[model samples]
Target chain A: MPIPDHVLVVDDDPDIRTLVGRLLEKNGFRVSKVADGKGLQQLLEKSQPDLIVLDLMLPDEDGLVLCRNLRSRSNVPVIILSARGEDMDRIIGLEMGADDYLGKPFHPRELLARVKSVLRRARSLPGDVQEQDANATYRFAGWMLDVPTRQLYSPKSKKIFLSGGEFALLRVFLNHPNRVLSRDQLLDFSHGREIEPFDRTIDMQVSRLRRRLGDDPKKPSLIKTVRSSGYVLAVRVDRGGESHGSDDSGPGD
Target chain B: MGVEPDKIVVQIDEDLAEIAPGYLENRRNDLKHLPLALAEGDFYNLRILGHRMKGSGAGYGFDGISEIGRAIEEAAKQENRQGVEQGIADLAAYLDRLEVIYA
Candidate 1:
């Protein structure tokens, strides 16, 4: 028998933890439950689960901080489950490196479908985002991005951390700099998925990426938004940078 | 003349049958906590419990509980004692009338 995928569910609510764990187990996945960030870190030490279902309102640490910490160390897929159902909350969760976000009171089947979709997408991706273009470095508008290390450095050598979503979006922008890419194209390129109807995922991603790049959203010089259409990376990009950016600070610095 | 309370039948997922009893029992226990929290003006604990109920109730086939939970949470935020009291009463009535059917 093929080994079932393992999933870690981190939620402070015992009822939620039990429900989600049981549901995943019934769906042929090995499931583990943790109530806080401390438990998450302890479990991560021994084994890396295939995916994680994290709650935003954790006791010891917020889910966003945990997701950022996970991104710095690994590319494990995360689906945030939170009670905060606002659009901004979902965008912020995505900005913190979550692959997907589902609010509390969600149907079990909906969460199941998302888990399957994310797992399938993760499998179809070329190894890992960090491994793809392992040795390539991208430069645009005096900013540097090292693909292998997933590091971004500003013109003045100040390091800025990009969440997984931000990094992928930025990479797409750098690859096709100075061109107007539609939302569908950007979503397909960055996420390898078809655009859902009325999806503002790409727009929110662009906003987050711009913030990471220090491009003001009010009047972004890079990643300029085209009204009623898409966005354009208005900078010239060069790929052959010998220097892999300079910053003494580590990830999440 | 004594009037009978209305029976509220909720059909829940059969997959949840094993755990739903314990979950419902916990909510029943909250009946005790709700009055104590209200009497002591422990709005924080009341808000936490209300938020949890709001987030979890509908998923478990208790939309009425979720509605009451939302009301309680909102009232606690505003520190409206009357609203919280009404919400607790509604929750008690609903739980008393609830009949869970696993489908």
Candidate 2:
């Protein structure tokens, strides 16, 4: 028999953990539950689960932070569960690198469907991290990006942090610098799927990344807006280092 | 007061059987904490508990609980003692008659 996919569930509420665990197990998944980020980190150390279901409001560390840290090293898909069911919250969850976002009070069946869908998509897509050389650092426009540490430094050596979304977007820009990337292409390359209609997730993320890169919103120099098209990174990128993966899988870089 | 049903029969998915008992027990415990929190004017704790219930109840096949939880959370946010009391009473009534059947 083919092995069941292992799913790691991280939530402070024991009830939620147990409830989700039972639901997944009943659906033929190997489920492991953890209460907080510490437990999640401890578990990720031992085994790499096929996917992670993380709660937004964890006691030790917020799920967004955990997701950001996780994205630095692992490509395991994540689905965020949030009590705050606002659109902004969902957008933020996605920006933090969640593969999907479900509001609390959702039907277990809905979560199950999403889990199956996300897993299917993950398997079909060429693993993004695996495509890039592990520990590879990219430098462009007087800024250095360290993939392993997921850290960015300006020309003056001041460290500027990027969320997972911003980091992913920046990496895409670096990989294909000097070329105009349409919004559709950006979403596909960075986030892996087309969002709902009228959703400005890609635009918002680009704005945020530009702000992080100190590019003027009115007339950005680093990542310039193309009229009626998309955006382009107007710089030459220099690549360094080999594909040796980093062992620092702990939270916060 | 509206007419009260003798039993609130909740048909939960059989897949939830393993955790349903503990979930219901936690709600019963919430019933015990409501009055205590109200007495002490601990609206923050009340709001937190209410929010938690609002977020989880429907997921477990207790939409009524989620409704009451939303009411309590809003009342606590506004410091409305009467609304909160009403929510607590409603929760008590619901829990008093709640009957679970895993289908």
Q: Which candidate is the best by TM-score?
A: 1
lDDT of 2: 0.82
Per-residue lDDT tens digits for candidate 2, residues B16-99, read: 887888898999999889889999999998998888888889999999988999999999999999999999999998988988
How is the predicted docking of candidate 2 categorized under the CAPRI scheme? Answer: medium
Best by DockQ, which number? 2
Candidate 1, CAPRI quality class derived from DockQ:
acceptable
Cα lDDT of model 2 by residue, A1-253, tens digit: 2236789999877777877888899899999999999999999988878899999887789889999999888889999987878899899889988999999888999999999999868754634642663577887767899888989999999999887778878877776566566787677776543233255588898899999999889877787777777877776677784222222121110
lDDT of 1 by residue, A138-168 (tens): 8877888887788999999888987777887
What is the model-wide C-alpha lDDT for candidate 1?
0.81
Which pairs of residues clash in candidate 1, taking residues 3 or more apart in a chain or in different chains? none
- Error of model 2, residue A140, in angstroms: 38
lDDT of 1 by residue, B19-88 (tens): 9998899899989999999999999989888888887888787888878888898999999999999999
